[model samples]
Target: MTIGEAYLRIAEDRFRRVKGLGDGTFRQLSERDFYERTSQHGNSIAIIVQHLSGNMVSRWTDVMTSDGEKSFRNRDQEFEPADLPMDLILEQWEKGWETLFNALRNLTEEDLLKTIYIRSEGHMVLEAIERQMAHYAYHVGQIVYLGKEIKGGRWESLSIPKGSSDQYAEEMKRIHGKNGG
Candidate 1:
């Protein structure tokens, strides 16, 4: 594959991996856990998901033509407590991801070099992708951390379980051979 094509694939895979982490955490949380706050000023998973969905919609819609920060997006409101139903929250989350994936799927290798505006500032399409990837990963990490804290002893490992590196490696080697390729 061409460099641009490879980059696009890698970017999509990375984003999917981040999303999967959040999904696993979500499966283990109760509906009430979505709205729980560890501190007075802390954001709940609900708020974080709302903010992410809002961001994804704003940034990915008409990405090549319009500024990422849309006029209608109330970023501040995304942080406020909404006490929304779980289904609605999940719907928003899915909508945001679908918007992002659609944008990525439509992009061409040549488009990666073109400029896109976020707010009033200019960023190359590739730069914008990287920026969003990092931002999303950060928030996903927060969600996972909070889920773990709330679940405490009941939490399951999203990745390799603690103190099992050797076992994990052996299993991988068995599946993928000694070189793991």
Candidate 2:
């Protein structure tokens, strides 16, 4: 994969993987469950998702020609809790990812080195991507951490459960070895 494609792949994987953990075992939490402990300094997963989506839409659309931070984006409002259902929160999550995928889908190899600006500073497309990947990862980490903490014992493991890593790896290799050679 091209560097851009690789970055996009990693970003998509990390985002979805984190979200999946919440959707299954931790789905019992309400909007209040998500927002209750977070202070003003921290945002809820919904806000983080909204902000991520907004950033993706701004950065990826007209990427080379425009600022990554949109002129019309209400960055602050993203932090304010909306009295919407958890379903709406999921919609925002999906829409944010869709916006990102839509933008990433249009990229070409030539676009990698193209110049883009964010907050009036110039960044190569790859640099912008690295920046965004890091940003999303920071938030995804937050999402997963919060879900795990909130669910406590009820939370299911996202990777191999507890002590099964070796077995999981061996199983994967065994399953693939016969098909390949």
Question: In TM-score terms, which candidate is top?
Answer: 1
**Runs of candidate 1 exceeding 4 Å displacement:** none
lDDT of 2: 0.70
Which pairs clash (backbone N, Cα, C closer than 3 Å) in model 1? none
Candidate 2 TM-score, true structure as reference: 0.80
Worst 10 residues of 2 by lDDT: 17-26
Record all residue pairs in model 2 with backbone atoms less than 3 Å apart, i.e. clashing: none
| Candidate 1 lDDT tens digits, 65-159 | 99999998999999999678988998999999999999999999999999999989999999999999999999999999999999999999999
All candidates' lDDT scores? 0.96, 0.70
In model 2, state the lDDT of residue 77. 79
Q: What's model 1's lDDT at 61?
A: 97
Question: How close is every model to the real structure, measured as TM-score?
Answer: 0.98, 0.80
Model 1 weakest lDDT span, ten residues long: 82-91
Q: How many backbone clashes does candidate 2 have?
A: 0
Candidate 2 regions with alpha-carbon error over 4 angstroms:
1-28, 38-41, 178-181
